[model samples]
Target: MKYDVIVMGAGHNGLVAAAYLAKAGKRVLMLEAADEIGGATASVRAFKEYDALLSRYSYLVALLPDQIIQDLGLNFETISREVSSFTPYKKEGKDFGLHISRVWDKETEDSFIELTGSAHEGKAWQEFYSEVEKFAQKMAPTFLEPLRTRREMKTLIGQDSTWEYLVEKPMAEVIQSKFKDDLVRGVVLTDALIGTFASAQSIQSNICFLYHLMGNGTGEWKVPRGGMISLVNELERIVQSAGVEIRTDAEVTQVSTDSVGVRVQTKKGDSFTAEFLLSNAAPAHLDRIRGKKSESALSGSQIKINMLLRTLPRLKSGADSRRAFSGTFHINESYSELEDAYVTAAKGEIPKHAPSEMYCHTLSDPSILSEELAQQGYHTLTLFGLHTPAELFETDPESSKKIAVQRCIDALNSYLIDPLESVLAKNSDGSLCIETKSPLDLEKDVRLPGGNIFHRDLTFPFKEEGDAQIWGVETDDPRIFICGAGAQRGGGVSGIPGHNAAMAVLAKG
Candidate 1:
């Protein structure tokens, strides 16, 4: 069938693009390789025996702009986490922790002072994030607009020193020079490394860090009230109402662009023709299908572990479990440990003490659990193991997965007064209600191309000098565009790429 636009994936981004185009009176057809949609933004009943719906991948919502929500009239909502993060550590045989509130408070200040032995690091923390917040405010408005060159963006931001440290210099240098405490630096640096596998000294980390902090101007990571799927469901509703035709399990096997239009053939023998095509698939995946050599990118380097805990575990630091697990729970993620883990993973070995972070979604919003389960004190724990690149599991996924999961458990146990296993909910088969996804597993399941969640390395949001790119969603072929994480200024759950791609197509009119 001939269409105005053929979206080659029904993930959230594709849906966003399709919805926008369809609403503008363009005929759009959305296709998905999987039986369902949502892509990494999906939420599923990972533990079937349980009544909880877990955001199987990409749990938090930080980058989604309110503009998209309002424009699309989406009913989706994200709940803010009161506690920002909790990092537990043992100093000279005494257990302690640093607890930071979402908004600056005495508890957060006191916690910082207690850990760093003064207000110096706390002051640095406030000043650093305050600068970032200002920078984010300036950058956020430009996300949905055309690509801005580095010079243009810097001028627009108007924070020369902040831009120099944040954009020009490596993240490691700024982080090391700004914060004195290793744990504090690690906490701050974690934003730069989430889903990205790069050393702090690498420019790649700088890009990731920028995206992490620049989300919606505040960079606040919030939990989707009804799991990640709620956002997808709202997008689905918008697209369907806008007359977007969606076909599941319609994987595009071949894509060819001509002067007239683009042609697509699916694995199911279905054919489609469109004036323009938008790919929500990773660029590497699209390149493979288009018969082009894919670009080199770092393999996905984080492990996702989801668990249904019977109850939250008590922390060794004596902080309230409800509070500690409510926010990002850092385990063995000290700055030195993070660099060491990266070094180990780079050498093709999972770090013996793999750094990970955990959070309890149910704590922030109990709606994901059934009334019975919520009343029974059930909670969900999500663990993300860093620096465990896909290559570590290439030879033996099973063996490596076991080792990686064990390392995460061991690390968490060290900081917990109550053992994790003791608090885990059990399945009907006598198995614990826990699931793990290695980088390799993600590739097999979601086609993430080497399991890199950001789809290749993330790029700096702005363009270099003399670039002709407009929306940053443009491709070599005028009739095609990338509307996925592979696009510049893409990555995370943000709909910027999708929105930009739609605007690009609309602008062509």
Candidate 2:
């Protein structure tokens, strides 16, 4: 059946595109390869270890366009998360709590300023976020929402100055020049890896944090009250509510665009046709289909890992530390250490001492499970091992998986100064809770490119306004449009990519 639009992959971006179009009275049909929707934004209950809604997406509410939430009636599906990140750094033998969440009220701010102890710490926190709040204010509405031409973008950000200000100066250099403390610099530099496959040392690694920074237009990251998946479920409802049809287990095999429009062939011998098509899958996956120019824009791949724990980590902050689940525990021995890990991964080898970013949102929201597991002390943990070399699994996927999964256990043990005593249990194998899931796994499942989360090496430095990606609205083809994280503004849970992509199409009218 011919449709107004066909969204492939049903990832958050796909769903976002479909919903927006459908909301505008367009007939949109969303399809997924998996039995359930949500590409990376999905929750996998197939494994008991991951039964609860662990974060396949980020918890930042800042970058998400609030208009979509209100317009689509999303607040009913998603709960507001209150916890912000608290990174604990061990100095010498003592542990320090970096309470990253900003308490909105003046009274709480004063109390926190006092609790922070050092004047520098308090001011640094305030200052960094203050700048972020400023730039990010321009990020979403003015930057993220609109789909414009290169000339239009240049005019908006200022042609000569914007490139020099945003792209030319890499994020790493910004940290070295701006911040004094290595610890503070370390914390801020880590933001660079949010959606990029860049090492902190990469020419412009920290630039990805622009989206991270912008996400909280006000510079505050609140977790969803239930878990990260709550956002996905809510997004799912938005798609459903818009009367957009979604089908899981319907893997798309190929896409062919022509004078007759687009035909999406599924793995199960089913073909869906549409006047306009948007692929929320990774760009690498899209490459396998019948498209050339559209597939070249993406970059990089990733390795994802998730862990379920019996209790909050026992850190130097104290065995029962309130900071255990404050946000995420980024285990980095030193700045050089993290830089080296990224180097090794870039060469296609998982580092023995790879720096890990553990997003422990489960602790922030005690109710990760549907209900039952929440009653138990079972908390979910997201251990993101970025820059894992795709070649590591070339000969032995199992070995790489084992090492990749165990690194979290080993890293956690090192951080807490105690071994976990074999508490790691796999969800499916009943061995360990750590699982080695990568961009390859995602690509195999949904057909995204190189398993690159943002569909390719999403470098903001390269997003020139005239570029199809910069605006993320228009596609090379007349009717075909580029939406989703793979499009312009790139990854994170922000539906801006899809939303803006559709707007570009609708605006053509």
Candidate 3:
């Protein structure tokens, strides 16, 4: 079959690209290797014994633009989280923790003061985030616009020192200089390390940090009204309405491009021809499928844990468990600990104390669970362990996953009054209601190429000299483009790559 354009994957980005192209009157066809769409931005009935729908891989919503939501008339909704994060600390024989909420109140201030033993650190915390808020506001709009150089962006930021500190220097330098408390610094630096293997000291770490903060212009991470699957289902509705044809389980075996157009061959011995091709697969994966050698260094560096809990675990810090688990419940993620974990993982060994984060999805959006489960006080917990690089599990993924899950549970247990196992829901067969996906598992499940969630190490959002201007989705082949997280400015559930790829194709006329 022939088409005006053929998208290589039906991931969220691919769906966004196809929707836009078809809306612009282009005949589009999308082929997905998996039976379902959304790629990592999907939800699943992971536990058969439970009635909860879990956002399997990509859990939260932040980077997706309001412009896309409005333009596509998407029927999706996100619930705002009142509490931003809660990090537990034990010192001076007291149960203390830092709780930052959407609004600054006396209780939050008191928590910081108690945890840090200084009002100055609390003041610095507010001042530091105020700067981040301003920076996010200035940079968020630029994401949807044409690419800008580092110089141009610096000028937009309007302060040489701020630009140098944030964009040019390592995130660690800025974080250390701005915040003195170890736990506070870690809370801020955690943004820099999500899905990235690099330490806070790495210059490249600043890019990851910046992306995490600039989502939606306010750095607010939100939960989908239902689950991540609803977001994908809405995009699918948009694309189908625009007359785009979609095929599943159609893995592309080879891609051939010529001066005129491109041809995509599937493993099922089917051929698809199109004037243009947009790939939602990782750049490295695309290279392999096209039988080309790729030198891209891409590897995922986090462990994802999905658990169905009978109830929220009681906290050792004496804070309300509901509030502690409402937002990001950080565990052993101090700045120094994060550094040590990075160093240990780089040596191909799991850190003695893993830095992880968890959140109760039901706390924010209880609609993901059925009425029976909600009445039963059941909740879903999504835990992510940082600095557990792909190398650590290379030798023995099965054993590594078991050890990693245990370490994460142990780390959480330190901050909890009752053990994590005590709150775990039982499966039909009487097993613990918990599942984990290592980087290797991500590679096998999503073809992420080294299990890197963002496809490859993230690049600067702007284009360099002699780079493609069509939304930074262009490749060496003019007839082909990238619409996945591997594309420039692509990561998370943003769908920026997809929208940009469609704009690139539309600009061809």
Candidate 4:
């Protein structure tokens, strides 16, 4: 078969790329290795007996550009959380927490004062984020355009102090200097470490932090109306409507490119040729398929736990369970502890106290549950344990996974008035309604190379001086391009890479 473009994965990014190309009158074929699509953005009924749908992998919507949704006319929607985050702690023999709202309010101000022993920290928090908001407002729109040089992006942002701390220096310096409280510092730092195995001092953390906050200008992590799958299904609908051909269970095993065009061979021995090929798979995976040396990257360093709870666990802090669980709940994730966990994990040992955070998706949108389940007060909790890298599970994977899961549970229980296990829904077989995905499991299930969620370490969303690439999606071969998370500015649930790659191909004609 021949096509104007062949997208080598039916992941959401591939779907987005195909939708744009087909809408532009190109003949595009999208092939998926898996039996179904969505990649890490899938939502599934983890428990067979329950009617609850859980976002099995990536949960929140942050980096996806609103322009893509508008351009593609996607019917998907995301709802903002009423609360931002609640971090519980034990201080001087008393249990308390810091609660913040999505929009600042007096109650949030009181909580910050109570937690930090004054209103000064909260004031600093506002000032720091306000500056970041300025930077985001300037930079968010640039993702869909051709790559800007670092100096040019800095100039465009036009905030020298903001750029100095966020771009030039390590994130740790600003985090520490801005927030005096340890827990407050940790809360700020968590954004830098999601799925990324890096210390606060690493410039890598700065890149991760930038992407986390630059989404849609506001950087609010919203819940998809149904689940993560809603975005995929909508994109699937758009691509189909645009007349893009799709093939599941067709894994592209080899890719060859020449001046004329590109050719790919699937695992089933099926072949296809295209004037241009876009890789929606990781760059490392693409390199292997193209018979080139793959580059090394940090292994994915987080464990994802999905649970169906009979009731939301009450916090020892005495905050409203509804408010606490609705937003991000931090456990054992203080600044010092996060760095310590990284040091321990870097040495190939699971942290004795694994730092984890969880939120109740059902709190934001109960529509994912059946009427009976919702009426019964059942909710779904998704927990992510950080710093448990793939290397830690290399020996006795199952045993190590069990240990990591238990550590996360223990950490959560420390601040809960009711133990998490007791509130968990049970299956007909009496097994707990919960599951954990180690980094190894992600690689096996989704091919996220060592479970690195961003496909590799994320790069600054710009080009270097004297770089020749226009769209930042180009590879060494003109006929080949990256249309996935491996592309520059192509991390998270964002479809920027797909849009850019399509534009790159269109420009050639």
TM-score for all models, in order of appearance: 0.99, 0.84, 0.98, 0.99
What lDDT score goes with residue 32 in model 3? 97
- The lDDT ranking, best first, is 4, 1, 3, 2
Q: Output the worst ten-in-a-row residue range by lDDT, candidate 1.
A: 1-10
The prediction achieving the highest lDDT against the true structure is 4
TM-score between candidate 1 and the true structure: 0.99
lDDT of 4 by residue, 1-509 (tens): 35999999988899899999999999999989999998999999999999998999999998899999999999999999999999999899999998989899998999999988899989999999999999999999999999999999999999999999999999999999999998999999999999899999999999999999999998899999999999999999999988889999999999987778888999999999999999999999999988899879998999999999999888888899999989998888899999999999999899988898899999989999999999999999999999999999998999999999999998899898899889999999999999999999999999999999999989999989999989889998889999999899998899999999999999988
Model 1 Cα lDDT, one tens digit per residue, 149-218: 9999999999999999999999999999999999999998899999999899998888989899988999
Task: State the lDDT at 18 in candidate 3.
Answer: 93
User: Each model's RMSD to truth, in Å?
Assistant: 0.8, 4.1, 1.1, 0.8
For model 4, name the residue pairs that clash.
none
**Model 2, backbone clash pairs (residues 3+ apart or across chains), number:** 22
List residue ranges in candidate 2 displaced over 4 A: 49-51, 56-62, 76-83, 93-99, 104-118, 148-166, 201-203, 291-302, 370-372, 421-430, 461-471
TM-score of candidate 3 on Cα atoms, chains taken together: 0.98
Separate clash counts for every candidate: 0, 22, 2, 0
Q: Candidate 4: what lDDT? A: 0.93
Residues 376-415, model 3: lDDT tens digits: 9999999999999888898888999899889999999988
What lDDT is obtained when candidate 1 is compared to the true structure? 0.93
